[model samples]
Target: LFSAVVAPFLLASIPMLQPDLQRATLNALLQISAQLPVNQTSAGISVTYPPEDAWLTSRWPLVINMLWSLALVIGLVTAVFAMLVKRWLLAFQQKRDNTLPDDVDGFREQSVGLRKWGVNLIVGLLPLCLHFAIAVFLIGLIPFTWHVSKALGVLVSTLVSVGVFLYGLAALLGHMVVSCPYTAP
Candidate 1:
């Protein structure tokens, strides 16, 4: 269920990897900068490339790529984790039946019994993990919006910030209120 919710977000961010719009903008800037008059020192050496070009061609793309890569990794890992948890639960349920042999019952006892491990804790934390993956994807999306329009970028950044803050506050409150079911991931 959590993986299903995160799939759309993950899919939405996949196109950011290409970032054609941003590349075109940077290419245009580079062309303009190339046309600008060159700067020469008394030593007779010409410096044609602007410092901004170095940043646009290198650092800006690096930041965007790194963020997207991280988000992708987090989303994939969380999805795999959810699958593992589902499999574990299913295996436990199948092994729970009395039709299994005595030896198999001993195996189940060692592995899947209610008191043998922190299965309950793992189940409780799945939602929190899902939220974390989604947050990462949202955060990585900011630069893409910025590339489109500064105002849109600001709007998205503000909204994402507020949403993250609210999630944190809720998690903190859940911890503080003993009766609350939500706890830290």
Candidate 2:
């Protein structure tokens, strides 16, 4: 979240602070202070970005876009993965609890149970693993996704990978807590 919001704000604010990049703007507070005396109001000073040197017109916009887009994609992927893990866990629990009829032949009953487990395992795993793989794949492709500074690309990708990995580990821990029963020693 910080990387998505604060990082872009940093890009916009840091450059503005640099003397070399200073652009002229009408100070609204100053205008208000002056107007307070006579009620002669300048409709709050508007500090509009020039059409030529607008913030979005610059490379910073692309960089910021890339940063936030990566953050959003990774975030959504993490949610999907956590859900998948939870689904798989629930299926396993269900299979474990299911009981066959006493009158049914053991061989046929065993085969049926095995088939059910197999279907559940495949159903639960396919989407989970596919989404995870795509996320990892896109993280690698981010740099090539746009033309941006190599350093920024590499930096964002590294940060994203680390963040995603830690998020996944946390999800795994959460799965463990939910799937396993607590037993006092």
Candidate 3:
């Protein structure tokens, strides 16, 4: 009963794992910055200053810090979400076994359907959702690369973000495959 009622709710909440929309917005800003010209000085004593690029030539430390922080937060959030899902499933199984009537075949059927549906939905959605997230994070790299100092930080953040997303996806897939009903020969 608990898995039937709660798994869908939990799965629907996966998008909330990425609570900070600021990361996507920052990525958009960086993408826009990539279109502008680089800062350069003309030959001779003359000096030239182009209009400050909104995306490039900004305080990179701040940007890098923000990106790394967002990645870390996202990773933690995903880990928590996975843990909660596992706990919920375990608790539901225990409760169902304890409380279900011995003759209630209909209840068993319904529980099987709910579990199958929830796992199927998660397996179908995980890849699409994480792929979009990774694309957004990668977009933030455009402006970060313009500065040598921020480049390393950006790379680290990007790798961590991608790694966490992949990890979560793998977990979801594993759950689906492992919990799938088996057929007898």
Question: What ranking of all candidate models by lDDT puts the best one first?
Answer: 1, 2, 3
* lDDT (10s digit) by residue, model 1, range 14-63: 55445467557776777776666666633333334434434244454556
Model 3 lDDT per residue over 36-69, tens place: 5455553323333344444333454355444434
State each model's CA lDDT, in order: 0.66, 0.52, 0.51
Q: Return the TM-score for each candidate structure.
A: 0.59, 0.30, 0.35
Reference-based TM-score, model 2: 0.30
Tens-place lDDT per residue, model 2, 1-185, is: 32354344434434432433323233444455555654356543444433454433455545544544555465556556667757766765565456444534654555577577675565556456545544544543454333346777777778778977876777666677876443211
Task: In model 3, state the lDDT of residue 82.
Answer: 60
Model 2 stretches astray by more than 4 angstroms: 1-56, 101-185
Candidate 1 lDDT at 5 equals 51
CA lDDT for candidate 1: 0.66
lDDT of 3: 0.51
**Which residue runs of candidate 1 sit more than 4 Å off their true CA positions?**
1-55, 99-125, 179-184
Candidate 2 residue pairs in backbone clash: none
Cα RMSD, each candidate: 6.9, 13.4, 14.3
Measured by lDDT, the strongest candidate is 1
The 10 consecutive residues of candidate 2 with the worst lDDT sum are 16-25
